[model samples]
Target: MATTASTTAPVSLASVTLEVADPEAAAVFHRAFGVDAYVGLRAAEDAPADGFRGFTLALTVSGPATVDGFVGAAVDAGATVLKPATKSMWGYGGVVRAPDGTIWKIATSAKKDTGPATREIDEFVLLLGVEDVKATKQFYVERGMAVAKSFGGKYAEFAPGTGSVKLALYKRRGLAKDLGVADDGTGAHRIVLGGTGASFTDPDGFVWEGEK
Candidate 1:
């Protein structure tokens, strides 16, 4: 028999969630997810803000020029470029930060995937850095996403539910050490849309926006 993920899970992300103190203001800065869930705001008492350390949202457009346009739009929206748009083995791409401070990566394939003429985000990936992949994986499991693939305690990938962006969990220190950075990510998850109802918080403090 073919296997399937659990359906009893309550949290179902409509799109990616982004918690903001002022949803109206935030609405102007970032645009990626099919849905953007919010908790309250970046300054909510329980969740404090900090430099983006743990997770990143990737937007893979269709081509190089399109990549450049997206990067430019980010900068116009108050993003600080971490890297300029350029062609490489990973195709043409660049990195930038939304005004709200979320790290955004825009890229395309190196070869034929330069993208079609229309240029649009064809793929999306959400990477969450956690203290323990197994534990975090279980947390999200309890929420909704199914474990599409995993690597012991090192990494775990969750299949996308109704949304296009796939979720993945990785060890905080492992990834930080790999990037030569310290694991200083805080609970102030500016966005955390997944699940079915009102906003909620996971064990690691990642927030999830619920259905209205």
Candidate 2:
């Protein structure tokens, strides 16, 4: 007789929910920022969270113009500009802290605009800043996630797998430095990830709940 092996379904990020004190206000800001479609808002306790929130939501666009456009819209929507849109060795991008305390990064790989900037997002990524990248990466892998890219202990990106938001892991301190913020934070992450299959908390305290 042949024995059968058990297999588990791969875990994918289905939705991202930002727990905000005022969902209505957060929705308005997200709408103005042009990312309302990518995130969900829910009412949460107005917990005291200082410094970086241990994560960032990044929007990848087409060109520099689009990057600037998104950043401008975010600022106009009452977000504080952490980093102005500028061309760097890797790309052109900027960082903004939403009115609800979520940090957002809008960036583009293309240095120049080939056409007019449109309200289009190429990719929505949730980068979790963890204390141990390798350990967390292994945790996700053991839970049936396939690694899309890995840079040793520094960074790790997982396959999106039909999910709306791509997931990645980065060192907490390094991620905060990249976003131009201090790495000292307390209280809840104030974000929830909707995942397919069983729910589990990651090593870094990021919560993932199975979608209903």
Candidate 3:
């Protein structure tokens, strides 16, 4: 593995293919946002495993109207609302989970003046709640991803590639608690990541596939 320095690697998420039980249904809900859904037996499985840990999809759009529109569309398509859209530290947005068991955060930066949304999902981030942020960040760094920003062992953020999704690391317990879920996330992550040196699962159990 070729580990990059703290801010040197060019690693970024290319796509997030979620393993879902019903690709058809999941697609119907996620289609608007460009989320690829496949039967993973997360697509083929009959039920969510005990302590099923879910990941959050950060949908960074243009502004409030776009945020409300997109997130509302998801809810209409069968997504459960985890948080209503509102102004937050990050921006104006909310959270929801599609029927396929994928959670999403629909948000926008308040400082942005980017008009309306250009795509259903402008920016995509796969936020993993890890047991140890330091170790996890190091694991990725060793695998060639450079750290864009980090707060010691608490949280770490990666910058986007030319056209890649962002990746971030946070403490598992704190993240789960923020999402109002159990820290012991079980079951498959049902996520597919591209644009890495190789394919492997992190210590926290989330799996990744390689693209570059």
Candidate with maximal lDDT:
2
On residues 1-212, what C-alpha lDDT tens digit does candidate 3 reach at each position? 32332333445566667667777777676665555431122354553554546467677877888888878788888888878888868678788877877778778886455676544566777788887899889877666677889999988988775445688888878777766566675666667666544566667776665553
Question: Tens digits of per-residue lDDT for model 2 on 1-212?
Answer: 11111237777789999999899999999999999999999998766666778999999999998998999899999999999999999889999999999999999988888999988999999999999999889888877889999999989999886668999999999999999999999988999989887777777778887755
Error of 2 at 120 (Å): 0.5
**Best model per TM-score:** 2
TM-score of 3: 0.80
Q: Between 1 and 2, whose TM-score is larger?
A: 2
Which of candidates 2 and 3 is the stronger one according to lDDT? 2
For all predicted structures, in order, the TM-scores are 0.71, 0.94, 0.80
Query: Any idea what lDDT model 1 has?
Result: 0.65
Expressed as tens digits, the lDDT of each residue in 1-212 for candidate 1 is 11222345455555765555666666656443221432223433455777545877777777777777778777776778877887777677787766666677787885444445443567777777777788778877776567889999998987767766767777877755533345676646666555565566655666665665
Output the better candidate (1/3) by TM-score. 3
Q: In candidate 1, residue 33 scores what lDDT?
A: 28
Ranking by TM-score: 2, 3, 1
Candidate 3, residue 170: CA error in Å?
1.4
